[model samples]
Target: MTELPGTYESYWMETGTGPAYPALEGETEVDVAVVGAGVAGICAAWELARAGRRVALVEADRVAAGVTGYTTAKLSAQHGPLYAKLRGSLGAEGARRYARSQQEAVDHVGRVAAELGIDCELERVPAHVYAESADAVDRLREEAEAAREAGLAASFVRETGLPFPVAGAVRVEDQAQFHPRKYLLGLVADLVARGGAVYERTRIVSLHEGEPCRLTAEDGAVVVARDVVVATHYPVFDRALLFSRLEPHRELVVAAVLPAARDPRGMYLTPERNTRSVRTAPYGGDERLLVVTGEKFRPGEGGPGGVGERYERLAAWTLEHFPDARITHRWAAQDNASTDGVPFVGRFHPGSRHVYVATGFGGWGMSNGVMAGRLLGDLITGGESPWASLYDPRRLHAHEVPSLLKAQGAVLKHFAGDRLRPSHADDVAEIAPGTGALVRVGGRRCAVYRDEDGGTHAVSARCTHLGCLVRFNDAERAWECPCHGSRFAVDGSVLQGPAVHPLEPRTLPDEGPSGKEGSV
Candidate 1:
């Protein structure tokens, strides 16, 4: 078996890290508090600050450390067949509105980058949605027509920059790609210059909703904002709005240094079930980082050997296609999807007027995130934006009721199955080094991980967010919640969240030191 690459590092991470910001000192009030400093929050803060409003942007970790850092960075509005789906669900006018919003987002990014003087390697390239099969070719043709009808500069094409011949594709011209982190940090700098505060490592654990929303951090700090934007990918610790509606999906991404000759000039994706997207990032050498991403799967239900196997599959596929490629980085990124296939980017709900949310981008964060920032900023500072009604969070389509119910069913299945089914391991002695499993410890299910150094760690198998069971993600070596996509480290620390709380540790019943087994 060919060995997979090293630890979960992204090509973007190899670049300069985000500038350090001090944690929030104490109680601070702002006009708008933007939580989660990924692309969405950064964009939101940028737009609000640009509007001369006082903003405080807080992050649990560093900026762009979440999905934004790991993205393939395709800044295209041509999300695979999205316009066609939007037309089907939201009618012709709604689809056109959606396209207009995304196009403006691309323009907004360009305007912001140029205004801020950010040299983030921004490039203007075409994006292609191609397919190898005849059935998908038909879908592409229909998709191209839908895109054109919905205000995109799209046309049907026979050939893309792919290594192999594509049967059909919908090519959208003048889309783009860029280094997300650099662009985001540039925004952060501008935010500070405009009297907006940026803080890191300050995790908001509880939100108290009132006339002025008060957020209590894990430390004793408090932030009071007239309005708040819940840009935390999936809205955390929620039962009313996002949790029940959003479906979390984990996707495998691999970045390999391919010869400059084989590098494709256009951002390309397929219409396959387990969709594959191919693009390249300039790394300043003969071997540019060619990122070929796909092999998406729902969490908890096993992959080849967890996500590690998914990376291997990506590697195998890369070797088969781009034989000259040398695999360098392998990582997985999680994305949320909405029942209606349109992102929820407005007020969190009708009841919560002061709170807004931007989630379920369906792996198109660059465009959607920028749109969220622009629309949310407009709604917050100015009156309601024209685009607000199209993406209103409270508006639920009748056709989407079935999708909502279907997603709820999956969550209920995982929540109930983990409680009913027996643990994967009965005895702690069964655990081996560098692996993890759910073990029946003292008649209670606990996740156990044996480190390569022979250290034993255990935590509650149930997720801290919504009580859904967390399965081990071997590729990232973390516990991933199948329901909401929260991830935890081996030591039970929160890695990514909708779950802000870490998994509580559980003591083994009768296990002794030095790998000794005792009776329960």
Candidate 2:
């Protein structure tokens, strides 16, 4: 079945047949409540259930349908020159703790995949961060040293199997990759079999923080639990003003059909160039597919050549390197980065006893997500985890202040700039079919999309989250806020959000286009 043309459709979601889960209908209670059904929530549910605790896993959509489903799924600790940067701020031991936690998560996933008899294409491959430029080679050398100090099996390898040449690379041994959705779905099944409950189409509208936090759903169902884990990719709460501290970046992913003989034998990423991440997934029984993802930008911003241009760039890159490769499927993913360059994984803040959150995994959600599971699971079970304080949401770093201030300034600029001048076009027919544009009607800005059937969808251009005007993200055919990472469908439905409310609907002008015939 073909998905909507411009909407975000992940290859993993289409290919994997995940298990069916029920929706919460009435009042429910559990020892621990998980607020999202991605890997982090899956891990928390699985861990708590395995430890003889009642877990009610609630998802706004189907299981593994969130960010974890769309990930490139590299289970490597070498997240693009991260340790060297962390060592400066988190100190040697703190950085080592971070690396150790990620390594443990990788090891756990591999072990669990085998334990559950899951055939998720799990492969143990050495991961490499390669550099093509001389200066980049120097940086790679320093990163190698940092990786070793942080307890990774790392070395600087001058020779790599990349189809293209590289000056040098940091090779970390025994890192793994797998079909993330399949692996997590296997865990989800195991959780259900072990007497855990999972609910889909259960959107948490609000959470009352107290003894046994109460989560009120959009449909008016309530779940009261001793502990609540908020593992939604971007934290749902804006109380901390995280919109300024955490920045969102969107990247294009393209997977090309390739012959089975073309195995790169490792997961590879380049930090110097346009930041390409490369790996392969098993296609049929005998064939393999190569995946490359890069070209980062803000959510609402599309390339000049159009929304489809980003896919073309990746296709061009693939044919250049591997001439026999054929373009197949492609999509986009939104990743959030903490200003301080680490994740916020423990309690929502130091003062909170029952509420916890896992967010800002940056682009490396796989390992960090699993680590968040283990960390949060331990905290809920009252176990002393060594990495707890390092990931505390309330932990303040002096370095992140400037970044937060700069991000807020950008938000203010976009908010003010969007309202400076309203576009004069009012007719719905002015918008071409299969495209969307922002225009003013009745002196109010509204986002308008014209479908191939000549139907128009119009909604308030102002984002519901913080009043920042959203822009038309042509690539995804959705409304994306540049300020705080909230997103909505063209029809005003909330997609991703710190915003619980949808965009306000607006009626368009009746007159189509103003075209007229001239009488001579």
Candidate 3:
């Protein structure tokens, strides 16, 4: 199935199916009411339920259908040159805390996966962070030292089995990967079997904070609970202005069938515009499929080639390097890039109790999601967790101010620029093919695209949700907002949101080159 809004048709979904959990219908009360039934929320529900606490897990959609379903699913303490940057900005103590917390999380997932007998194909693999440039080698060395100082098992490796060459790399041993959707669906089933309840298709519209927080769904159902965990990838509440604290980045992934000799033993990555990650998943008794993902860009930004192009490049790269490779499945995932370079997994706001938000996983959602669940669970259960200080959302770091400022500036620029002009609605011919242009129609600026086939599409320049001007993301072939990361298709269909409304379509005025026929 092609990629669709709110639906994740991943390779993991091919595994055995599970029972469905319906949405919240009427008033429900629980000891802990978790919002968003992705990994973080489900993990929280699992943990709390195991502790004999009444838990109600609520999801806006099906289980594991959000960011969790689309991840590369690597569980590791290595967070892609994160520790070295953290050491410089947040000091050695901060970096060490971050490493220890995530390491604990990796262990936690392994333990849970094993304990539940989940057939998610969990296994240990060494994660590599490599560099191709001389300067990048130096940075990689610094990061290796930082990782060691943080008590992580990391070292510089001069050799790897990768088909490509690299100057140097850092190996974080004991990392693991699994079928993400399989493990998540298993957890959901286990939670239900253990007498925990979850509500799918129940969107929480508002929350009333008090002794017992009251969560109201769009369908008028309410869940009053002693604790609330907001793990909706990007927090739904704008009260903390999380939109300003982080930026969104979109990454692409593709799976291909590989011969036995072509399979990789572990995960590998390089810090480049086009990164390559390699892992393998079992298809049957003797067949395995390779998973490859890369192509990173700031939200709505990428190379001249977009998601499809990147997928093709990865497939080609695999074939050139591993001769027996064959393409099969492909997809894209988007994650919030925290300004501080670490995930925020604590209180939702200053002086707020009984409310917690988890976000900013930075493409390492597998372990970070567990970290969030465990930490938030501990906090809600009135227990002390050593991981809290490292991920505290209230903690301020001055270094992140620059990234935040730049992101805020860009968003403001787009929002202001969106109101300046109207878009042209006439025809595809007005735009030169292969280029994105802005034009005015009805005194409103909109995005106009002319495809290579000479067909044209015109969409509302103003993003549906916040009125920010939507920019043409040449890479993904979609309309995106610099403000809140909403994505739409070229034909004015909603792809992702913050914006629920599709770009309004307009009819073009008929005109011709010779002034005798309709054009555009």
Q: Best-fitting candidate, measured by TM-score?
A: 1
Q: Name the top lDDT candidate.
A: 1
* Better candidate number, 1 or 2, judged by TM-score: 1
Per-residue lDDT of candidate 2, residues 138-212 (tens digit): 888888999999999999998887778889999999899988888889999999999999999888989888998
Q: Model 3, residue 185: displacement in angstroms? A: 1.2
Write the residue-wise lDDT of candidate 1 on 1-520 in tens digits: 2368744687787784767899988899999999999999999999999898999999998878888888888898889878888889899999999998888888778887898899988888899988888777777888899999999999999987887887889999889999998999889988899999988999989888887999889998999999999898888748345778889887788888888878889898885747888888787777677888988888665465666677777778877878888788877777889988888998887788688899989889999999999889988986667789888888888999999999999888888866888887777878877788899766778888888776678898889887888888765678888877788998888888888888988877656665743221
Tens digits of lDDT, candidate 3, 1-520 = 1232222246665453666778898899998888887778888888888877888999876788767777888888898887888889888998888898889988987888888988788888898888778678888888899999998999988787676788999988898888887787888888888888889878787889998999998779999998888888877776777778878887777776776666567788876747777777776655677777787766544555544466566667667767777666667788887888889898998978888988888889888888888888788788899868778888777778899898888788767865654453344456755555566655656577767765556666777766877777654567877677877778777656555457887544443552222112
Model 2 residue 388 CA deviation in Å: 0.7
RMSD of 1: 2.0
- RMSD values, in order shown: 2.0, 3.8, 4.5
The TM-scores of all predictions, comma-separated, are 0.96, 0.95, 0.87
Q: Sort all candidates by TM-score, best to worst.
A: 1, 2, 3
Q: Give the range where candidate 3 is weakest over 10 consecutive residues by summed lDDT.
A: 511-520
In angstroms, give how far residue 62 of model 1 lies from its true place.
Answer: 1.0
